[model samples]
Target: MRTVAEVARMIDHSLLRPELTTGDIETGCALAARYRVASVCVRPADVPLAATALAGTGVLVGTVVGFPHGGNATAVKEAETRLAIEQGATEIDMVLNIGRLRSGQLDDVEADIRAVVTAAASAPVKVILENAYLTDEQKIAGCRAAERAGTRFVKTSTGFADGGATMADLRLMRATVSDTVEVKAAGGVRSLDTLLAMADLGVTRFGATVTDRILDDLDHRLRDRDGWTAA
Candidate 1:
């Protein structure tokens, strides 16, 4: 197994707080830099600033489209996706319309994701199912919808919902999505054990606010272990 520090680099260091200021995003970017994280997931309004701040760094810029609540108008979400990409965002995470999907309005749900996928173009897109609000059947359906929409990833949650990602949910999602599509287990993903466990379950990416802590734990262990082999 890889050390926690090794896995921390796959995390999209997230800051989705509504009240977070530019300074807070700057701090978040600095932390990502220190940890050599994969990317910094921030709000749309902060995307340009983050892109600029992270300039010349390997960390990519990411943002949410429909956000915690996937109830936004489809056109609105598409516009947001387009604008974010134009602003230099390397990736987009879009929330599925939970109500529509639950009601079995699969067309609307599929179209919603398709629009964003079209707008995102070459940039990878992650569809957030907010699985805590979904049943097993709905989760399966959402994964199918994401596949039909050509999304690059199927994410488990927004973390703003009552619950976040779970081992059961991640395993289910992994089973549903094709080998080509990736799974991102987000929300409630903290600590080295959970991170490594999820990675072993086929999750190549993670979204979390505990990124720094995980990296710190990994770094401390790395120093003690002499090399990553012992970790």
Candidate 2:
């Protein structure tokens, strides 16, 4: 069984709901820090606030570019990536151009992702394929494009789509990308079992909104299994 700390580090505590307030971001950041999660995936506008709250906590600040829809122009997404990093975001999750990908414009898709990756420089970039809208073939192509474009991760969803990550999708993504490019499963990853199942299939990162619940469950289970007490 994975330890609570190990599970916590895999999560990118999601705070990207469109209606979230500044106070919500602060609260979310505190939760992420307490849990020592990998990062806080916040909205673009909230990057600075999240950065301030998570400073010295060792939790990275991540923001979305192009967001739920990957329709933004390449230039716009590139600008968004630069500005977010400038404002203290240490990681970026950018939505890929789903329309172009579906239209079989693979080259365009590669260029679009490369633009953001270039702007991100040293910071890692996770390309959100939003798998809910893609076919398996398209998913494979997106994974390949992301890898070729030099992205650090190829993500499954943005959690706002009609569907979320599925086992079939995760398997396909894992098979499509080399180990150099990691896979992130987002959306509907709200339980320990679900996360573990995905991890079994080679998923390395998760985008989750229920960080507390997942980590708390793991902690309880570990304590019960080992007869250990919390310090």
> Which RMSD values do the candidates have, in order?
2.2, 1.1
- How do all models score by TM-score? 0.95, 0.98
Q: In model 1, what are the clashing residue pairs, if there are any?
A: none
Candidate with maximal lDDT: 2
Q: Ten-residue segment with the worst summed lDDT in candidate 1? A: 222-231
In Å, residue 210's CA in model 1 sits off its true spot by: 1.4
Model 1 clash number: 0
lDDT per residue (tens digit) for residues 1-231 in model 2: 999889999999999998999999999999999999999999999998999999999999999999989999999999999999999999999999999999999999999999999999999999999888888889999999999999999999999998999999999999999989999999999899999999999999999999999999899889988998866
After aligning candidate 2 to the native by TM-score, how far in Å is the CA of 118 from where it should be?
0.3
lDDT of 1: 0.91
Once fitted onto the true fold, the runs of candidate 1 whose alpha carbons sit more than 4 angstroms away are 3-5, 227-231
